[model samples]
Target chain A: MTKKPLILVTNDDGISAPGIRTLISVMKTIGDVVVVAPDSAQSGMGHAITLNSTLYAEEVFMNDGPQKEFTCSGTPADCVKIAIREILDRKPDLCVSGINHGSNASINVIYSGTMSAAIEAGIEGIPAIGFSLLDYSWNANFEACKSYVKTITENVLKNGIPNGIVLNVNLPNIPETDIKGIKVCRQAKANWVEEFDKRKTPQGKDYYWLTGKFVNLDGGEDTDEWALENSYVSIVPTQFDLTAHHFIKDLNTWNLND
Target chain B: MTKKPLILVTNDDGISAPGIRTLISVMKTIGDVVVVAPDSAQSGMGHAITLNSTLYAEEVFMNDGPQKEFTCSGTPADCVKIAIREILDRKPDLCVSGINHGSNASINVIYSGTMSAAIEAGIEGIPAIGFSLLDYSWNANFEACKSYVKTITENVLKNGIPNGIVLNVNLPNIPETDIKGIKVCRQAKANWVEEFDKRKTPQGKDYYWLTGKFVNLDGGEDTDEWALENSYVSIVPTQFDLTAHHFIKDLNTWNLND
Candidate 1:
């Protein structure tokens, strides 16, 4: 019999969140699961890693699942690093992060701790995927997410992701029956038009809270944002190489040497 | 005479760090300058923003450069957001981050707080560049970096960076005379091979310090790692779009829907 794939699971939402808990249950049906996720919520952490401080990871029993779990005192990227180097006995066949509480599509990917964890695994040469639901609530329904998540994860295990590439999968927050089929698409051109909520402390010192409305500027019908808005699951094949290969020729024409 | 360009300067290193001081001085020679940098060092912060916490920015006098400076209690990305939305009188013409005390070359860009600030500005439709030196020292010499910094900044003002893109520029840590001309290159495939320095706390609890040796897996001479290694300053035109456009066609062939 073929050996069950070793899958490393993680999320930016602390491990106990329903998003990850639902994710954990889905993975248990497919493989030998090992979870090393942040001990607390690390939302908006991006690709941040702990450098100047000490890191602690403690094994814990969230429940009586066959999967072993550890709570890590670092960002999502740190959890992946510690899991690969210190915790796992061997390389994981697949690394899946999230089932995150919010969207990680378009410009949101740059600020996503969920995508960062998956990207971290991709950097380490593992085939990885980061999954997110459009719902941002703490009690958002993840019951609709399981079948889609399982399908994608199984497909990934069957057809491996290419080197320097990972998947950013964002699910629409709708009933499972209402969901359309999955669509592979590009990241949309979008940005948060930040409006700082300026307020004062009790002592009258000025401070601000970061707030914004996401503006989707891309008119492309073939974008992740469009797919999600149309109730289809979006799978944007994400890459770690940030290079704008098309711009290099134009930049070389500049008079830098002269 | 043309009006001076409004330039916003920032760094992941704190406002008082020599790196930003030099960056500020160089920017002043080209434009009217404003500095909004971290109050404390925020290295390795990646693209993180201050979403979960309050942000504070206070006007501070750092030396006698012709730049108005604010020290912000936020990450590098936060510094840019606050600078543009809360502090600046109008939208700045350019945003330059770092003269970073270390290299943000190759895969380091994924974890760079310095680059994140520049990227933040780019997302907001401002032309941006992130500069870094190969030397990782509190007292790395900024003298050799000034002329190159000035040249690059001038070029960006003259030739605006395309929308949805930013520049990741890394300088060789050599003398000014030893430096070759700038080379526009792609980011090399590289990553850290992490080694956890496992240790026990005073109370006998286990902990670890994250450390790693950077491994350049790519031998391509057209990469940022190659340019920096050959003593040329490297400028990688980077994009925020993480979509793997090449692999989308292949992903669509999968039986995800079936």
Candidate 2:
């Protein structure tokens, strides 16, 4: 008998989110699973880790295929920290995060809990992948995404990711058949142009809800935004190093020490 | 009389950190300062923003100086968002963050509240910069950095930063006389080799504290790490476009559509 691969599962949408639940169901077919995830939704919480308060991760559920689950009071990145440092018996063979309710394509990867979890695992030297749906609706169809998720996870398990790199996978909301196979792409040049909805409080205090339109400046058909538009599952091999290395030589000209 | 340059101030160490105090003091000499920062410390909070909770910015202090201040209940990025949308009478001439207690050089910038606030402002079309001291101690010597900070800020104010570009300035901890001038540099290839310090809880459970030693892999004297080592204030021109444009072409070769 072969040993099942150890899989660490997490998500930004809390432990009970339908996205993680679906992901967990898929993982059971491939490995021995351990889940450590936020107790509540943590969408748009890019790369946050807990330091101020004591993290609380309780083993809340068991008996579903011998997998243990912990509901954690931390960000998705924090969940990965606690799992690797305190909870897991050994390092995971793979770390998979999300089937997120919203898109994490283009520039959104920088501000995404889904992708951050994957990046955290990559930092720990574990191969990881983050999956997200183009649809933001809670009831969006995830059934269409299962096979591709399984395939990508399997491919990662077979061929390890390069050092300092992880995978950022975004799926379109179309049906599985309409979905083309995964296309490895780069993060698109995009950003949210915030249009703050300024309103007054009932007590006459002014407040604002941070809202915006995501603008894609990159028109390249090879970009993630373009891949998803053409119904392909986009896979961006992402890294944790945020350094803009190309600008280093130009900066050396400044007389900083004088 | 010439109108004072409109300066927006924020920090990762909350509105009340000594770091921001030093930053606020310096900015007052150069501009009409408007401070909107988190009410509590937000160290190590990487690019997180408030969404689940409503944000509130209160007039926390009325100072004797020309600067006005507000304490916000949000992350460093949120402070920038709130300031740009509501607090400022017009777009700020320059946005400055930190005098951060620890280093934000190399890989730390990705996980820095100080730098992220500046990055957030830069993303929103504001000319911004994040400053840091190499020393982590609260009593870190900032006096030596005063003139350099003012010079850099003034040059930036006089010659606006390019659209979508900001600055990441790291000051070496040393005496004023020993300090070298500033250098334009690039982020070094570096990482934190995290060592998890695990411990047992009172209830017989286990928990862990995340700690690490940074490993600098870039041997180039032209990098930020090298700049700091040479006692120069490292100024890396940074941008918020997270697109990996180089990787897009390779992704198009994948057999996704077939």
Candidate 3:
């Protein structure tokens, strides 16, 4: 008999969020689970680490779940780092982040705390996946997502992810039966068109609130945006390499030595 | 007669840091400059933006330099967004971030606030470059880098950066005469081996200070790490599209639905 795989679980949302609770419940059936997550919400943190200050992680009892849990005072990326470095006894078989409260589909992945955790784990050579729901509320229904999540997790364990890559999975906000299943896709060319809500404070100091509208510039059928829009779960294989290899020759032609 | 280019200058090291000050000086010589940077240090900010709070930007007099300056209460990415949306009179001809006090070579780009500003600008269809010195000190001499900075900025203006790409340039900490010119390279595969220094607070709470040693796993001669180590300025063409295009077909073969 094989030992149960030790799975590391985490999220951008605080340890107490409903989304993570749902994720924890699903993972408990699949592996020996250990969770280290932010003590408070760390949405939109990207790949930030706690470099300027100290970090604190205390083991806490959130529920009677079999999975060991720790609440960390750091970004999502830091949680993964501290868990692997100081908390865990050995390397994890897999790392899963989120079941995040919102979409991390296109350019949103660059600003996502949820994906950052997964990416951090991927960098550390762990097979990882970041899951997000299209719904962004405190009480978003994740009951419909449990079986699909389980299926994907099992498939990842069975078939290992290619080196330097992790899965960015986004599930549309619909009934699981209505879901058209998972589609392997590329990230869409999309961005948030920022609009600042400028205002003045009572002390007469001017301030602005960051707000944005999501815009999809790519019309291709093979993108994450299209899959999510058509009620399919999108699994985009994401990598940490920011290099644009194709453009190197062109850049080389520039007269730089002069 | 050619119009003077409009250049937007920013940094993760804050507006008052010597790094951005050096960048501003170089940029002023090339164009009509505008500086919008974070009011405080944001070293490990990555691609984060201020979402949960109000952002404030106040025009400040830093020096008698011709460039306009605004110190913002936000991350590096936020400075670019707010500049493009609320500050600048027109879309900038070029956006340059950093002259960062530390290296953003190899895998560090993923956690770099300096590169994030440049990537943010690239996403907005602007030709952008992020410059960093290997030296992490506040007093790292940037005197030797001025000519190289000007040359690279001019080349970007002359030969535009490809769409969906930006440059991550790292300079070695050596005298001007010792520098051996520039090399176009790929991001080396490297990561931090994290060390968490556990300590106790006065309240008897255990805390950790995050520290690490960077380990370069790739020995490729055509990598940014090699170039920087050899005392050459390294320029890696970076992109924001995180999609692992090569792995999509294999992911499609997974048993995701069943």
Candidate 4:
């Protein structure tokens, strides 16, 4: 019999959120699962790491599960760092983060705590994937994404991800039968037009709540936004290397040294 | 006289840091400057935005500079967002972040609050550059890089940065006379080997502090790490889009749909 792969599971919406719980359940079926996730919600955290603070990671037995779980008092990236460097006995076969309560598609990936965990793992030279649902509510139905998630996870385990790359998978908020299969796509050129909801405190001081409308500026049919809009699960092969190689030549032309 | 370009200046080391004061001084020579920076140190904040908290921007009179300044109670990314959305009367011609108290070269960009502010501006369609010094002390001699900073800032203004790309510029900590010129380069493949400083609290509870030694694994002479080591200022054209376009075809071959 083939040995079950050791899978490291994590999420940004804290250890007890339904999204991670669903991810944990799926990972348990395929591996010797070890979960090290944030103790509280860390949505929109991006790639933040703890530097100026102390971190606490305590083992906890939540539900009747075979997985060994710990709740970390740090950002998602910190959780991945601590897990790989201190928690796990050996490097796991794969690292997966999130069945996130909202979409981490397109520009959202830039501000996503979910994808940040996966990116942290990728930086550590581990194959990783971050999964998200289009719905944002805590009670979003993550069950609809199980089989698709499993298929993608198994494929990653079998084929192995390219070095320096991690997967950003987003499922449309639809039933299983309506998910028009998974489409390999690119991150669409999209952004949030922030509308700060300005309000005053009791002492007449102004404060702002960041609220924004996501706008998909790209019309490419091969984009993740188009895939999700068409009821298909989108898989954008994301990278952490932020270098714009094509423009490096143009930058060299500048009279910088002169 | 041609209208001076409206320049937005910000940093992660709080509004009072010498690094940003130096940046503000340099920017003042090139344009009408507006300084909107974090109220306190927010290093290693990455691309995090203020989503869960209320944002406060208070006008402050710091040093004797013509630059309009505000101290923001948010991360570096939030400073950029609120500057563009609420503070600035018009979209600034350019956004410059940092003269960061440390090197944001190579993989360090992934966790830099300095770069995040510049990247946030880039995402908002503003030409941006993030500047960093190799020194990591509060009193690091930022004066040595002033002329070079002016040179690079002028070059960027003259030749507008390509759409969707921001410059990540790092200067070696050397006397200005000994500086070996500037080089446009790629981000080096490098990472930190984290050593969690595990300890017990006074209450006997276990806690940890994250510490690491950077290891540059790449041998390429054309990387930022190489340039910095060779006493050259490095300018890496950075991008916000995380798509791994080269691997899309390979990912399509996976049995994801099947």
Candidate 5:
């Protein structure tokens, strides 16, 4: 018999989040699952690590699934770090994050704790994928997305991602069949037009809550935003290499010595 | 006579960090300066935001400089976010962050609060650059790197960074005469070999501090790391497009439907 892949699961949503529960349910069917996720929601945490405090983890039985689980008192990236360093006996074959409580499309991927955990795993040489639904509810409908999740996860395990790369997958909130299949697309050229909700504190100080309208300036139909809007599951093969290779030649012309 | 550019100055190392002070001094010679930085150190905070709490900012007088400064309680990225939204009267002609009290070269870029601030600016369609020194001490000599800082900042203002990119510039800790000039380079193939320093707490509970030795496995001399090691200012114009474009064709070969 072929050895089952060892899958490490985590999320920006808490360990008990409906999204993670559904993710765990799907992962358990494909592999020997070991789940290590945050004890509470950490939605927009990005890639933060808890350096200012102590960390502790506890084994918990959350469901009837055969997958063993643990709750960590840190960010989603922290859960992956602790799991890879202190929890797992061997390096996991795959690390999957989220089934996130919200969309991690376009510029949202940069601020996403969910995608950050997966990206962290990719940095550690583990093939990782972060899955997010367009719904940002505490209770999101993930039933129709399971089979597609299985197919993608299976493909990821079979083909594996390249060095320094991970997958950022976003599913639209639509009927399963109505989902017009998956598209391997690029990140849309987009940004959030931030509108800070400034308020006077009860103690008589001014403070602001960040609010924004996501603006997609790209007209390209082959982008992630286009794919999602058309009801196709969007998969953007993402990398941690931030170097803008194309601009090196231009920057080199600068006469810094002058 | 041409009006000097309006330069937006900020950092992750807090408004009073020696790095930001040096950056402000350098930017004064370039243009009109506005400083909006975190009120406290946000080391290792990568692209985090203030979603759970309200952000507060206040104008503060610190020493004699032409720049106007504000201290905010938020991450590096958040400072950039709010600066654009509520602080700046016009979109900044250039955004500059850090002559950081540490190295943000190679693999460290992913974990850098400094670069995240600059990347946040890049996402907002602004020309931005993040500067760092190889030194990581509060008393580290910024005086030694000032001339190069001025030169680079001027070059950036004179010739703008292209759309969809920002600069990650790391200066070596050597004397100006010994400096081997700036090099436009790629990030090296490096990985942090984390050696968690496990220890016992006061209650005898085992705890750990995340520490690591950086291992640069890439022997390519064209990388930023190689430039720095040779005592050169390494300028890597970083981009946010995370797509692994080369792998898209191979990924399409997968039998995803089955």
Candidate 6:
């Protein structure tokens, strides 16, 4: 028999969140599981790491699931770093992050802790995926996502991901039956139109809460936004490279040496 | 007479850091300058935004410079968001972030608050550039970089950056005479090999300092790493779209729908 794959599980919503708990239950049926996750919710952390401060991680018992777990005091990216460097006995075959509480589609991916963990794992050369439910509620039902998650995870394990690339999977909140299947897509051209809600402190000082409205600037039917809106799971293959290679020749033409 | 270009300035290093001070000076020579930066150091903050807490920004007098300055209680990305939304009287002609204390070349761009600020500005359709010096010290000499910064900033203003693209410029930490000319390049493949330094706290609980050695994996001469190593200022045209377009076809071939 083939050896079971070693799977590393993590999330941005802390180790004890129901999202991660559901994720852990799903992973256990597939492989030998180990979890290293933030001790508290690290939403909107992007690709942050704990550089200026020290990190604290300790093994914690939170579930009856067979997966070994450790709670970490750092960003989602840091959890992956420490897991690879300190916790895991050997390299994991697959590293999966989240059953995250909300959407990480389009421009939201740039500010997501869930995707950051998956991205960090990808940088370390592990096949990685980040799963998210469209619902942001604490009681968001993840049961409808289980079979679909299993199929995607199984496909990833069967056929390895390419270098420098990882999968970003976002599921619609509708029932599994209503879901229109998975669609391979590109990230939509979208952004949050920020509106600062200015308020006064008790001592007459001014403070602001960051708020925004999601705007889909791209009308493309082949985008992640379109997939999510039409009740389909979106699988956008994301890469770590930020370079705009096509524009290099144009930039080089500028008269800079003078 | 044409109006002087409006320039928005910010950095990962706090408002009072010598790096941003030098950046402010260079920008003032080019346009009508306005500075809004974090009140404290926000190194390694990545693309993080303030969502869970309140933000406080206050205008303050930092020096005898004529530019208006506001010290903000948020990350570098937040500074740009708040500036565009609440601070600036008009949309800036150009947005510049950092003469950062260290390099944001290659994979470092993914973890850079300096680049994040510039990227944030670029997302708002502002021409933007993030400048960094390789020297990671508070008092690193920035005089050698002044002329280059001016030239690059001028080029961006004269010839606007293409939509969805921003510049990530890293300078060699050498004397002016020793420096070669600037080279437009691609981000090299590089990553930090993390080594967690485990130690005991006062009460004997274990903690760790997240530390690492940067390992440059790519040796291509066209890469930013190679340019910086040869004492040339490197400019990588960076983008926020994370999709690996080349992999989309292969991903579509996956048995995901089943």
The lDDT per prediction is: 0.94, 0.84, 0.94, 0.94, 0.88, 0.94
Instruction: List the RMSD of every prediction in angstroms.
Output: 0.7, 2.8, 0.8, 0.7, 1.3, 0.8
Q: For residues A6-98, what per-residue lDDT tens digits would candidate 3 score against the true structure?
A: 999999989998889999999999999999999999998999989999999989997658789999999999999999999999999999998
Summing lDDT over every window of 10 consecutive residues in candidate 4 chain B, give the lowest-scoring window. Answer: B62-71
Q: Write one digit per residue (lDDT tens) for candidate 3, span B1-258.
A: 899999999999998888889989999899999999999999999889889989999898987587789999999999999999999999999999999999999999999999999999999999999999999999999999899999999999999988899999999999999999999999999999999999999999899999989999899999999998998999999999999999998888887876
Question: Per-candidate DockQ versus the true complex?
Answer: 0.92, 0.45, 0.93, 0.90, 0.72, 0.92
Worst 10 residues of 6 chain A by lDDT: A59-68
TM-score of chain B of each: 0.99, 0.96, 0.99, 0.99, 0.97, 0.99
Count of clashing residue pairs in every prediction: 0, 12, 0, 0, 0, 0
On the 0 to 100 scale, the lDDT of residue B202 in model 5 is 88
Encode model 5's per-residue lDDT on B1-258: one tens digit a residue.
998788888897888889889888888887899999999999888878878888998899987775788998999999999899899898999999997899999978887889999999999888999999999888788887888888888887778888889999999988878997888999987977765677887898766677768899889998999999998899988888888888788878888755
Which residue pairs come into collision in candidate 3? none
lDDT of 2 at A116: 86
lDDT of 2 by residue, A68-172 (tens): 999888889889988887789899999999989999998788789998899889877899999999888878789988989988888778767666778889999
Docking class of 5: medium
- Please report, as a residue range, the 10-residue window in candidate 1 chain A with the lowest summed lDDT: A58-67
Docking class of 4: high
Docking class of 1: high
Worst 10 contiguous positions by lDDT, candidate 3 chain B:
B58-67
What TM-score, to 2 decimals, does candidate 3 have?
A: 0.99
Error of 2 at B84 (Å): 1.2
TM of each candidate vs. truth: 0.99, 0.90, 0.99, 0.99, 0.98, 0.99
Q: Candidate 6 on B1-258: residue-level lDDT in tens?
A: 889999999999999889999999888888999999999999999899988999999999976589999999999999999999999999999999999999999999999999999999999999999999999999999999999999999888888899899999999999999989999999999899999999999999999999889999897999999999998999999999999999999888889875
Across B146-193, the per-residue lDDT of candidate 1 in tens digits comes to: 999999999999988999899999999999999999999999998899
Highest lDDT against the true fold, candidate: 1
